[model samples]
Target: MDRQDCQHLLAALGEYIDGTLDEELCREIEKHMAECENCRVVVDTLRKTIYLYRVEAQEESLPQEVRHRLLARLELEG
Candidate 1:
């Protein structure tokens, strides 16, 4: 994968996966992915990873240390 061509796509991919990216950019990313196998793999892997995390989070609580760190990172510990 040519990094230059993929740089912008990588930056927006998270937002794209979350459905928060704008329509025009999303279309462009989709078009790019159609021709770029590496980007398709990246997007697919992220989608699957996020899906698994959501499923597991719904079923189980985080360990205390993990929970504490997460809360602290998010500035929600207070």
Candidate 2:
């Protein structure tokens, strides 16, 4: 796959991992991945990173004061 094709597929990679991509798009990505080791590695790394973050974020608790301060800062910025 060309750079543009890889770029296009990269945007859909997250959706593909989440099983939210349509079948046709999934097939297209699969086809591209078959011939593109680099893109496959990109997809694999992205998936693993997202999974790791999900697990870590769930296991770790954010302090309530920190959460309130962040929300207040966002509100002020908005």
Candidate 3:
């Protein structure tokens, strides 16, 4: 698979992980992942990160200052 194929599959990754993908697509993704270590790592990390976040406490909102700082950092990096 090429970069575009990876990008398309990446968008459906959550559904793939949840076992909601159609059989043919799931097979294709499995084949792609088996041959691509980078995609495999991304999928694994996303699953673990989501699991960690789900176990964390719920928060209604971030403080304004923290949000501002985060946005500033993201902008700088971007």
How many pairs collide in each candidate, listed in order? 0, 0, 0
lDDT (Cα atoms) of all candidates against the true structure: 0.89, 0.89, 0.84
lDDT of 3 by residue, 1-78 (tens): 358779878888989999898999999888988988889888899899988887774645799889889989889533
Instruction: List runs of model 2 lying over 4 Å from the truth.
Output: 61-78
Question: Tens digit of lDDT per residue, candidate 1, span 5-73?
Answer: 589998887799889999999999998999899999989998999899999889896699999999999
Tens-place lDDT per residue, model 2, 14-74, is: 7899999999999999999998899999889988998899999898988988988998988
Score candidate 3 by TM-score against the native.
0.63
Cand. 2 TM to true fold: 0.66
Using all chains and alpha carbons, the TM-scores for the candidates as numbered come to: 0.71, 0.66, 0.63
How are the candidates ranked when ordered by TM-score, highest leading?
1, 2, 3
Clashing pairs in 1: none
C-alpha lDDT (0 to 100) for residue 19 of candidate 1: 94
The ten-residue window of minimal lDDT in model 3 covers 52-61
All predictions: root-mean-square deviation over Cα?
7.9, 6.9, 11.1
In model 3, where do residues sit more than 4 Å from their true spots?
58-78
lDDT of 3 at 5: 70
Name the runs in model 1 displaced over 4 angstroms: 61-78
